[model samples]
Target: MSPSPPLPKERRIRWGYWRSMMKIELTRQNVHNEFAKKVELISGQNLFACYQCGNCTAGCPVAFGMEVGPHQVIRYTLLGLEEEALGVNTFWLCASCLQCTSRCPKGIDIARVMDALRTVVLRKKERKDHVRIPEFPEGFLEKVPQIAFVSGFRKFLS
Candidate 1:
């Protein structure tokens, strides 16, 4: 049989390959940052345990309106992209219903994580970038502090 030509070597890496590689490197670096440690400490949850199962996404009612879904938020948490995760409107939009927490196969307290992300975002003043929904019910922020104070006092008494 005639000798076949040798298979051609790939002369250039595709853009997708470079993008994926960059994303992976960024995720690795993010996971090792101080903000990630702070997030874990404040949330009292191990973000690294998540496997991106999408249960949180399925449970999120506002995820459809978010730039990043709940599952992506969890992934961002695991990747340690604290600013990106917290800066996103998704964290602010969380209803704190605990559906994500209840549905997580790994038993990750996703609701707690959302609360932690919100606290961090507020502390950093990143809420300035959050999209304002005119349809959002009034007196939302007013109720939160009262609830938090009551809860804190209850805890203190306990």
Candidate 2:
């Protein structure tokens, strides 16, 4: 038999007092360049390259397990929703296998872009107390290998 149909893209709180489906109300004032520009600079991938065809998400091995897939990450990143993109499991769960990059019609290196996003959020001084950056803490540092240690510094450090 065919696999069961997927759930709807949007959802509602029918039982609760909240009656409307969740919506992203994009205010004109909220749109800004700070986040997306940094991601593009770090990844060296143009946001203009993406046309939202969902190829990256479809080819991702871990997409099924991610709270946000590669495509949504790109969309959210471009939309300047840095917190939303950074807060998701998509970047952490990515295997860096390059399946999404290889399959992209836009020739975007989505995996690298995800890494760039990770770098931006992890390196933010203001966010340190809230998130556990894998690079920090003495016990965590010594246990992590040299390659990982160096790579983390290179990726996240300015």
Candidate 3:
């Protein structure tokens, strides 16, 4: 049989980069933290149901721009790695189109999970006094009425 062709240099480099992901030691306490519980409560989805099928990430339209992607965020949450899960911009970049939700074989509402993550990140105890609107997408400001933006800012900003 013929030997397999050697991978291109760039492909090999990319493989190495993926192989260098951070390692974490999981424990019962860390895996059952309040953050994970809150996420499940807010999202009303079973975090343990996901089996890392990669379907959600594969179907996400903006996954390319995300630092961690949806699946990784869920994994981090399940492992009670709140800081790591919240640190990535994956939840912020979510388009909320439900593409990932639709593609999930486990029937998880991935969009809701993203929303819950956003809520947790934005409403941290230290930042509760300061509320601000998230950055509107390009062309969104132009399309939305000024009064709506004004009312929302006034209500949220307090």
Candidate 4:
């Protein structure tokens, strides 16, 4: 005889049990750095608290467009892999819509973390604006709506 499929309630219980039993530990020797400190200060989040569960990435609406998912970025940051953390377009693609924050089981405000990374990237003296107003063609700015131009600048610069 074929086995019956699990009921919704039973499925939920099994899923919860599975989640509770899973544990991920950080194995890297170096876990702290100036970059992580800066991110924690700016975002008011403990980078080490994230265990790479990927709930944030799973819920992010813009994750499809990101070069790296939010959870991976957090892992990179915690590991002091600044180049890996900052090199991806994950933070840039974040909509700041709070979806990731809402889905994080650890109560981490991941949107704030993305914002912090953006701030760090922009504040660096060597990094130039990915898109500068002065670099745009004169007619392009005039043709674009004021709100669009302002929002673009804020997204790329701030």
Best by TM-score: 4
After best superposition, candidate 4 residue 85: deviation in angstroms? 0.4
Which regions of candidate 1 are displaced past 4 Å? Answer: 1-23, 26-30, 125-158
Output the better candidate (2/4) by lDDT: 4
C-alpha lDDT score of every prediction, in listed order: 0.72, 0.79, 0.83, 0.85
Best by lDDT: 4
Candidate 2: C-alpha lDDT: 0.79
Question: What TM-score would every model get versus the actual structure?
Answer: 0.63, 0.65, 0.68, 0.69
lDDT of 1 at 33: 73
Which pairs clash (backbone N, Cα, C closer than 3 Å) in model 3? none
Candidate 3 C-alpha lDDT tens digits along 9-49: 65675756666665577788878888889999988999889
What candidate 3 gets wrong by more than 4 Å, as runs, is 1-26, 128-158
**Residue 59, candidate 4: how far off, in angstroms?**
0.9
- Candidates 1 and 4 compared by lDDT, better number: 4
Q: Which stretches of candidate 4 lie over 4 Å from their true place?
A: 1-29, 130-153
Model 1 C-alpha RMSD to native: 9.2
- lDDT (Cα, tens digit) per residue for candidate 1, span 43-93: 899887888989898887778888888779877777766667776888667
Clash count list over all predictions: 0, 0, 0, 0
- Candidate 4 per-residue lDDT, tens place, 1-158, comes to 99988777645667677777766455545676788999999999987888888999888888999998999999889878899999999988888889988988889999999989998898888875466667877788779899777656766785
